[model samples]
Target chain A: MTGSLVVVGLGPGNPDQMTPEAAAAVGSAEDFFGYFPYLDRLSLRPNQRRHASDNREELARAREALAMAAEGGKVCVVSGGDPGVFAMAAAVCEAIEDGPEQWRGIDISVVPGITAMLAVAARVGAPLGHDFCAISLSTNLKPWEIIEKRLIAAAEAGFVMAFYNPISKARPHQLSEALDLLRRHLPPDVPVVFGRAAGRPDEVIRTVALKDASADMADMATCIIVGSCETRTIERDGKSPLVYSPRSYRGGSI
Target chain B: MTGSLVVVGLGPGNPDQMTPEAAAAVGSAEDFFGYFPYLDRLSLRPNQRRHASDNREELARAREALAMAAEGGKVCVVSGGDPGVFAMAAAVCEAIEDGPEQWRGIDISVVPGITAMLAVAARVGAPLGHDFCAISLSTNLKPWEIIEKRLIAAAEAGFVMAFYNPISKARPHQLSEALDLLRRHLPPDVPVVFGRAAGRPDEVIRTVALKDASADMADMATCIIVGSCETRTIERDGKSPLVYSPRSYRGGSI
Candidate 1:
């Protein structure tokens, strides 16, 4: 039996957001590997074996999956959002590059899913309607200086921004520092969206002005979106107000 | 009779990539509105009415959909890829903000889909594994100057960049200019992916160095990904080499 491995994204917290391709990939796998919460979200067949690891064990988990696939075991590595975005796909690729040469022959593919920022954008109207940037505030992999520089550049270029891994118990100060960097370039009234556990039953989405935004609004599970200068909010009678950036730009010289 | 409008994405050309929520939204709609090509891709139910318009009629189509929904019709406005990204959700919101007050009362929601960039990233490995920015190369709505400025900022900040609508028959020079600007800050061998009609039957994905990248490599259907300095290409025995950015950054004062 020739083994294969596929990295599939579960897509936020909603099964409805998962693609048919992703579902099919998951259904066919004999072994599943992922972070504990994500692994717990799946219902496995009686014969299937699941390996749930901590979040910090991405590289090790990826190596294990590759080894399983090499030994002719069908393996599926899962991620909460699109596997290619700060998830298992890259980790798998890194494993392939550094592992035994024979591992390269295994069939590997990435199945995309609806990412957190886009799901949050849809729920709060289309704040990402125009040009945008997605940056992760986690300092575990990249340095804090690089994150700060990217924030300043994104704001200066007038791109709507989505911040992933915005806040965590260990890295509490990063989101606030990032927000302060944005405040230097963006207006005080710029709209900011704090979306916690988007697409889940316990999801909470709050829209606040840049001046009123606080770091306490987010946690590791939250995704935050800061709108460009063109983003606007439309008040409604009994529903949440709509937030969207207009498709056209008029401020920059034509 | 209550009216409702749901903007749904078909998700990068592949039917398998379409989410269950998007499929459900389209299934229940009495009327469907979208650009001609996207509308052509769908087979409507016998009772459903399909309104296919030219690509340039987004706002007008949005208004018509809103009007129909306000008149107690279940309307679905469709776009390829996620509706919230450079698509119909923002147009519908803009229509609501500018249209009569009654339009705002119509139930409106956006269903997200696997966007083009993510689909392309999955196919070519995770070059978007780190911080990234997405910009549209089309100069019809925004000035070329702003696009130029954003490109410079993105390059300076060491972002892997995704350029949507990279080239078209009407505007061919913009992509080359964008590439030339990147050539200044990015290394000569930085990987550039030209993914045309990604996830479709005739999908084509080509990875080249920045030094060899050209304007004619893409058209409107193409999504171009320019790798950050950290992106690496791993050679395989008999398969396409994988391109991905390491999760950790080693440059810029780590």
Candidate 2:
């Protein structure tokens, strides 16, 4: 008997943001594997078994899930945001590449969901309306120098940036370092948004200019978006300002 | 009476991919405004009305939608993918910024949905697992020279790139020009994916090396992803290759 493995995203901590395809995958799977918090988001039937692991145990979790699938069990892997973006999909693919041959033969498919950056971008206006890039602030899987280089390049190219995993107790200094580097390249008035737990009940979305933005405004749950020069804030008489990046750029044909 | 305007995404031609929040917004709104094809995706109630227009009239559509909202009518503006990303949200924000003062007082919220690039990435593998940038190849709102500069900067930054509106009959040569510019900066063997009508019944996804990626491979319906140097393709025995950019970088601590 041949079994299958499906990977799906929960979409930025809100059930309403999850896609129907992901919900269907969750409903059909007999076993679920994921980081503990992601797996907690599911209300599985009694027949479904849960295999929750730590945040850094992606590869091991992938291997175990693949083995279960190879054993003719319907398995699913869950991720917090869009599975393809710095999540379980890449880990599962890497495991299939290096694991036993049978693992490659198992049926595998991925369902997309709303990523954190997109959720955060929506809460604020459309700071990502034009060209944009997403970078992870954590250096656990990449070097600080590479991150710095990318920041400079993104600024020079006039691309708005979204930063995931912006801060944690372990990597307290990186976010500040990144912001300092960006301050040198981008204008002081550039809008920087700190969106924590976007789409959740206790969500916090704050916008500050580059000169006033500090590392303390963010946490591990926050997704930060730094707007390009073209980004603007519209102030209403009685409401908070709406921030957005205009579609048309300078020297455009329009 | 205070009216609200909500802009939402239909998510790459699939009803299953549309978020519950977006669906709720659509259901609550009395009137819908969008381009003709995007409006065609919706099935509204008998009381609801759709105001469809041509593609290029974004500002005019935004103004009309905002006017209705300002006059105490529930309004919704729909876009194909995530509205914040090269879609209707920016146009709506632009209209609000330039229109009458009361337009700012209307309640406005944006609901996120599955973007085309994320859907295409899930179908193959996680090509956007690492740092990535998205650029629109259409010159209707931006200059060709700006696109070229951003392309060069994205390549030098070691970023996987996603191209939106890559080609059209009017802009036939832009994609080729963009690829030729990347050929100078990126490796020839880097993977280039053309994902046409992703999540739709007639979807076609093709992967080729940068050297083989031609303009004809893409159309306005396609979302093209260019892998970074770190991206790899794993070949299965009888199945198609899975493409992914590993989460860890070359100089990563892991």
Candidate 3:
């Protein structure tokens, strides 16, 4: 059999959000590689084997999948959200660039899925309907100064923002510091959304003002969306309120 | 009979990219409302009615769907990519806020789909693996000044940028002007991916240097992704080259 490697996204946590292409890729693979939680999301066939690793072992996971595929095994690498968004796709590519020369010939393709930010945006109306930026707050690979600079620039540019890995036990003060920086630039009434486990059964989506946002409101599975100056919320009698940023922007100072 | 409305994304164009949740929402709806091209992507059942309209008539289309749902019909409003990303979800919410009071009571939900940027990013090997921003280059709704300011800020902030609605017949010069603005700040060899009809059968993804890119390479169906300073490309022996941005930044001057 010809060796092949396909990176697929399982989507947030909902089976219904998984695309047919991703599901088909998983079904046809002889070996699956991913983080423990994402690997658990897939149901292995009788003949398939799974390789589950920790979250910090992305490079190791990519090497394992590449090695298996080079030995003529059909391998699938999975990520919770779209693999291309700060996930396995980049890790796989990085491995191929640095691995053995023969490993370059292996067939590789990335199947897209619904990412967390967009899922959260859908759930909370369209806070990202206008121009927006996505920044990961984890300082594991990059410095906190870089994240701070991007946050400040994004705010000054009037782009609505989505922050991934906003808060975790390892770093408790970053999210609050980021929000404090935004509060200095953005309006006090700007809408902020905390989406935890979006698209899952126990999904929680709350829209708060920038003045009321706290770092403790988010965890690893959460995506925090901060709206632009134009973002607004519509009040409903008995239904959940809707929040969105209008596509048009009137003249304003940045 | 109770009424309901769902705004769903159809992914880029490939049926395999459509999520099961969005497919089910379309399957169960009595009325389908969308742009002519998007509505054409869906197959109607025997009792389902398709309401296809022009692209510029988003508000009118939202009103029509709301009116139908208010009269006890299950309505599905569809957009090509994720409905919440520069699509119909915001329009529907706007209509609900501005329209008759009775429309607010209609059950509405937004089902997320794979957006064009993520689909294109997957095809091009994760240029968005790091911090990124997405901006619509269309000056139809917003002013060219704001777009220019955003381009400058994003470039200054070292963000991988995705440009949606890059070029159209009416605004032929906006993309070139935008590229020219970026040329002033970014390096000349930065990789730029022009992905047209991203996941569709006729999908075309081409990577060119910042200096070699032109306006005619894109249409409304295209999403232009510009790499950050850290983005790199790997040459293959006999296959197409792969492009990606590394997750690490090694102390670069912004």
**lDDT tens per residue, model 1, A158-243:** 89999998876778899999988888889999999999878789999999999999899998989999998889999888889999
Q: After superposition, how far is residue B231 of candidate 3 from its true place, in Å?
A: 0.7
- For B1-254, candidate 2 gives per-residue lDDT tens digits of 76899999889888899988888989999999999999898889889999999998989999999999998999999999899999889999999999888999999999998999999999898999899999999999888889998999899889999999898778799999999999999889999989988888999999999999999998888999999998889878888788999998974211
Error of 2 at B22 (Å): 1.0
Writing each residue's lDDT as its tens digit, candidate 2 over A20-66 gives: 98999999999999999999999999999999999988999999999
What value does the lDDT take at residue A224 in candidate 2? 96
Off by over 4 Å in 2: A251-254, B251-254
Give the lDDT of residue A234 in candidate 2: 92
| lDDT by residue (tens digit), candidate 3, B2-73 | 599999999999999999999999989989999989999888888999899999788899999999999999
DockQ, each predicted model: 0.87, 0.87, 0.84
Model 2 residue pairs with clashes: none
Which candidate, 2 or 3, would have the higher DockQ against the true structure? 2
Cα RMSD to the true fold for all candidates: 1.5, 1.9, 1.2
Give the clashing pairs for model 3. none
